[model samples]
Target: MKKLAFIGLGNMGMPMARNLVQAGYYVYGLNRSKGKEKTFQELGGQAAESLSYIAENADVIMTCLPQPADVEQMLTGEEGLLQMNIKAPLIIDFSTVSPSLHTAIETKATEKGARYLDAPISGGTAGAEAGTLAIMCGGKKEVFEEAKPLFDVLGANITHAGPAGSGTKVKLINQYMVGMHTAAVGEALHLADQSGIDQSLVYSVLSNSFAQSKIFDRHYNDFISEDKDEPGFALELLLKDLGLAGEMAKESNASLKAGDLVRDLFENADTNGYGKKDMSVLYQYVKQQED
Candidate 1:
């Protein structure tokens, strides 16, 4: 049994680290946020003294941070993974970030005789809570194979795309599509409600017709039926990921005007105080227009 140090105990990370513990890994929860520390401790997990402490103690390290810069700081900063004296612990980064950052982290890990896996996830917070995420991963074949079972415990679909950075590449594509679909859902539902039709009637028709999608099933109905806007995935975070997707596309010389267009939609939501709402709650943008 490996000693796993799981970092970032936010909405996504907390449930994931808890899943690993339930799966029988000797896991340490490394949360810099002291508030989360007590919650995790209440659940019977130990918190390390510092990042360097986890770096020194963890045999398998996984992080679910928010950005590439945070990932870099975790891997190379003063209290970073590179500063720790260890011989080849497998480090899994579950952050949504650039492929270049993935590659750069792998190089740094190599210098310490350690290995790294870039695994950005999908399926939202509901998926995270249920351990049903779709994990797209990039690393060496052997490393990916070794990590696949653990990923399977956390997600429904775990695919090894290629070498380091490829997972982030694939995730960028996934996020672009999700962003477009979310904006479309918002716009279509808005128009449907304005047509003098009952919101439930419109939601049901669209959900059963060819116009339906996971977003429709999850939110269109929820919006009409309950006005539920809990954070299965946050709007602000989606905006951040979409922004990263646009950046990744530009770096690859790929065109993603659809991604760019939706980026603005999400950005507008953030600016209008919908940042804290669930990503699906972008419907509020349309609802506000109606009001």
Candidate 2:
């Protein structure tokens, strides 16, 4: 059994680290915030004292941070992992960052005698808690094979996307669709409200029709119906992902005709105080828009 250290015990990371502990792994958890480490320790995970402690002791180091900069800091900051004299540890990243940054980090890891994998994940907080996330990995195939068992413990669907950065590329495309579909769901539901059709009726009918999507089900069933906007996935986070997708598209010279419009809608909504709310709050934002 490989000793593992998990950093960033936020919404997705805490549950993920907890799942590893439940599976009988001697997992060490570190968080920038204060209370989460205490919470993780209560769940049978060791609370790592510092990045140095993790670097010196952990056989495998995993990160599930929110942004590319956070990931980079964990590996490249003055007190970062790469600065420490770590053995040849396998590093797996579960953040949804850019392929360019992912590749850059892989190069840095290589210089430090560390193996790297870009293994961004999906399925939201529910999937993270349920241990059913879909993980897309990019790295050497042999390195991927060595990490498969750990991935198995964390996710239900895992795929080796290709070489370094390929996983983030695939994940960015997935986020592109996720943003588009989420915006469409808001628009459709708002249209239903404008037509004076009961929102539940619209959901019930469309859910079984060709118009249905997993995003629709998630937004309506989990958040909108209950009038709850707690952040299963934050609106701001989706906006960030949409921006990253747009950047990737520009780099690839791919034209996404509706991408800019959808991104603008989310941006306006986030600006209007929906940033901390569940992404499904886009429906409320759409409904409140001036006709």
Candidate 3:
């Protein structure tokens, strides 16, 4: 079996890496923060001391960072993966980033004799913990086939979207709807509150009607119902994805009229200090807005 190095042990990455370890793979878990490595070690995974250690030893390197800049830095920075003399590792990224960035990384990987798959994931932290993420991969079919077994351990719905940047393209479209639907849920619930209708009744009815969505189910049941607002998927992260989606539309010379308004909603919520909270907290922000 090939040894794997899993980097960025955050909300999504930690559980995904843990699933890999539980599946009997030899995984070296690395994180920028201090204590996560120790936690991963306790879960029967090795803790990587440095990127150099991973570059020298890992046959497959996987990263699940938060931003495109972080992904680029981890690959191209001083003492980063591409800077080291690696043995042509299979690199997989499970972060939501721009397709253009994925294309650029693929180019760099090809130049370095490394294999790359842009395999951005959906299904949030709950799905990550349950090992049921939907992984959309973009790369050579042969490379994707080689990595499919590893992906199987991390996701239930896995697809090879196409080559180079295709996976991110699909993911961006998914996020586009996610952002819009999230905002709509906020508006619907706020309307219910203002009109003296029961929010729970509204959700129950919509959940059975055409107004239903996975986002509505999750946001209401997990966060909004209890008023918790923990970061299952952070508002700022969704804002970032919405921005990426808008950029993608612009690049394709397509118009996303409603996308602008939704982006502004998220941006306003972020600016009002709801960025780090659960994306469902957009409800609170929406409720505060006046006509």
Every model's TM-score = 0.94, 0.98, 0.98
**What is the Å distance of residue 31 in model 3 from its true position?**
0.5
Report how far off residue 276 is in candidate 3 (Å).
0.3
Model 1 clash tally?
0
The worst-scoring run of ten residues by lDDT in candidate 1 lies at 216-225
Tell me the whole-model lDDT of each prediction, alpha carbons only: 0.84, 0.92, 0.94
Best-first order by lDDT: 3, 2, 1
Write candidate 1's Cα lDDT for 140-175 as tens digits.
999998887789889998899999999988998888
**Which lDDT value does model 1 have at 288?**
92
Q: Every model's Cα RMSD, please?
A: 1.7, 1.0, 1.0
Q: Assess candidate 2 and give its TM-score to the true structure.
A: 0.98
Clash totals in order? 0, 0, 0
lDDT of 1 at 258: 68
Cα RMSD of predicted structure 1: 1.7
* Residue 48 error, candidate 2, Å: 0.2
